[model samples]
Target: MMTKWERLAHELRLKEYTHLIVGPGASFAYLTGMTAHVSERLTLFGMNADGHAALLLPKLEASGVPRSLQIHVYTYSDELGPVEALKAFASDLGVHQDSRVGIESGHMRIFEEHALRQVGITHLVSADEVPMALRLIKDSHEVALLQSAAQIVDAALTSTLPLLKVGMTELEVAAELEYQMRKLGSEGTPFGTIVGSGPRGALPHGGPTTKQIEQGELVVLDYGALIAGYAADTTRTIAFGEPSIEARKVYDVVLLAQETAVDGVVAGITAEDVDELARTVITEAGYGDYFTHRTGHGLGLDVHEYPSIMKGNPLVLTPGMVFTIEPGIYLPERFGVRIEDDIVITEDSAQVLTQFTKDLLIVGD
Candidate 1:
């Protein structure tokens, strides 16, 4: 764990800004080692260039700030109004009318930005871009946490397989999977559990519904777990019984596409190049339109982060950067096949984090 002062100094050097403004996301947690519930009220962390930091919070939440931060805390009463409180705190903290401040634009609401400007912070720059660049490279401890989260997800999926027999509703399957993940010590799922069967399976972001599973249908299971503030994502397509030739063909093609994309993931390669490897395979299989959405996305404190694998992204792969490589072909009004795996770029090659079997599993009766 990095010290608050150390992290603040690092950000100042990397972005060449005098101060860092943190919000209520992983960035805040990473910088201060504090996790406070997000609310309409603004929670800001201002770290100056001198390695000194201050926290601005509501009076109600002032007590919630961790004792380890060892920084000055300014609190505003709800009755006093947030803007007035913010202005007073900024004045007390010596924020001048022309200080070069770095703000997280992604998390800062327009109203909040306006309030900051009202407080004489005119030379504000976006801190999100540079901070995200720093976050893209994970340390060994972060990798271990992600690996543990992946193991928990694998165990949950493995335990839920027996409950996926014929006649089970898609919603029921999803509920069972979530329950198993919680039982296996996962805090919660990173995203909604996808338990699409038959035609619903064709929808990439389909949620579990009341549709019942039947024989000779395809089922797509895409789920993940949040463990220790880290996230893991994986997907696998299985057959309820003996799948039709068309379904089998599509599955094989999608599997091949995913493998090709994974093969293309190596250190120094661009994210777009990796995506093209999968896109080319699916397009050659004559399912170009069916393959909607990007090839993959980065996963960590947030389910989605930087270094997206898509057609236009030019981020270069590097060791310690983790992401998902999910390739799918969705046939309208029929079914869809998706194979996803979590991969972390290493020095030599890509390391697959999820250890579950990718071979199509066929359940019967």
Candidate 2:
């Protein structure tokens, strides 16, 4: 099997790209296999088809690079500018005056691009599809990391629910869950923990707030953990007490939608088809308009990656592809219910990575 960098070099050669630039993000981590804190600083790694690569970092960050990779390391001090360092690294990589460099358009900074332009490299194009395709399929090792991360969050959620109280704020619950995730061995969280309760649950991405949890309301806990650079995302909606008839009905519909979608995960299925399956369930439940957002999204190095599970997407599912199956129903001013699970496609069917029981939980009884 070709190494990730070697495969990237092959892509560069095939695309006739003279160089490939990656900045800090999942794309950077995917290519380099080394995690670097993302900042405004001009740290970067440049690669070419000739198997030549160069690393330019702030002097203090130079030591973080692995000693095994034989790439040229160019360090810049606070006194010396990053522009000169970029020039030196560009020369080391043999990026010519007219080199057609490829960059991750989403993550590359304008200053970084200007540095390349100043260093005599001319043409630059987006190589966004390269990493998107390369990282879409998870290898066994990647799967294991995702599975371990999912297990940690599942265990944490299982242990944290019993601690919920009626008067606690949404932020408090989020903090406690994060604490449990960390205690269960997660290196970090994939994103800001969301603990939307009561009417706020209608907001799809409503982050945790200081609003107190009240009785007879639904709380949506949307969060995930990151381990070994891979991520696991899941959402579970629970009631603080006996919710209204409408709330319980919506919860049942969302749960059914989530389960149906998860069951439809198999190799060769179109992403849109999986999405429609869930959407159909919600529509038949008389909450079609309430089912906002895509049914799910791919989860990996970053929380949201390629292969979005939504209507009109043509991407076909395949073994090793993993994503979330979160179907939600949000009735404004009433409540919202979203049940999510991480799903991995197999040779014949799908493997649900998240082990949390999706059955509705009634807390603070």
Candidate 3:
């Protein structure tokens, strides 16, 4: 009964891969439940074909490794330098000059790559596929964690919505939302808390600012909470006082598109098809250009994962895959409307994890 990682190692060996190296990121946290910070110091998780695992970390961080992994750890101090330690660890893992090793190109530093080359391991290739394949499907335990994180954020959003005022600055709303999330037991925010009001909402990646929220404007709250290393992302648009007819039309169209996309999350559907469904809905309403970004992105240990929901990507939907279904319409020089929710594919259909109300909220002055 080998674990998923152990089975991955066995498969890599059959494929002639000598070792798969991982740095501190979602993949490392997924493989090992222990969270380690990515820093200037070198820390790596190496797995061999025989399911043997090793950790090369700073001497101070050695204690962070969980006892359950049973991984061999090699530590180096500042005085000794990390190159020699990497050499010894590579030898211990049986990586040689001709060994076909796999490394995470994005996370592994050039310093470590050069160190491996110096130590005679020259056949290093990208190992991103191995972990991506393993992480796309969420196990029961992982699903539970994701759901729990979603619940925490939903509760926080529900509680904070009432505290939003016409005079409150976007930054103030963001701070209040974060406070509620932490009070509800979230470890921290997955990304920067977004509270874009009025015309700022038109900017997809807009952050909170000192500008005060005004009446008759649409405010977008796009935020998430992190718990147990899993993340939850959700977005909802609130209308302070009565919004303009144009803003109302945008909100209604976007809401319909978002709901339609969520209902389209059945097994066997292509990710592109889902994106197309939402795009068609908005496009038919004459706001296609306003729907600028992709339909959505996958989520789990990392906020953005695999199986991107966008046109031109042929990835099929499968059970155990979790992602967000967010469709937005941003009208430049005006306001924007976005509705987002976390969803996980079931055997036959999909389950929405975030329970926040998607109905347009009209708050009075």
Q: Mind giving the per-residue lDDT tens digits that candidate 3 earns over 1-365?
A: 76877777876876678889888889888888878787778888888888888888999988888877777889999888788888888878888777889887867788778767777878999877778888899988999999999999889988887887788899999999999999999999999988889999999889999999998989999999988999999999999888999888889999999999998789999999999999999999999999999999999988998869999999989999999999999888788899999999999899999998888898746
Highest TM-score: give the candidate number.
2
lDDT of each: 0.85, 0.88, 0.88
Judge candidate 1 at residue 212 and give its lDDT.
86
Worst 10 residues of 2 by lDDT: 31-40
lDDT of 3 at 342: 94
What is residue 20's positional error in candidate 3, in angstroms?
A: 1.1
lDDT computed for candidate 3: 0.88
TM-score of each: 0.91, 0.97, 0.96
Question: 164-219 in candidate 1: lDDT tens per residue?
Answer: 78888999989998999899889898789998899999999999989889999999
Candidate 3: misplaced stretches above 4 Å?
Answer: 14-16
lDDT of candidate model 2 versus the reference: 0.88
Q: Order the candidates by lDDT, highest first — what do you get?
A: 3, 2, 1
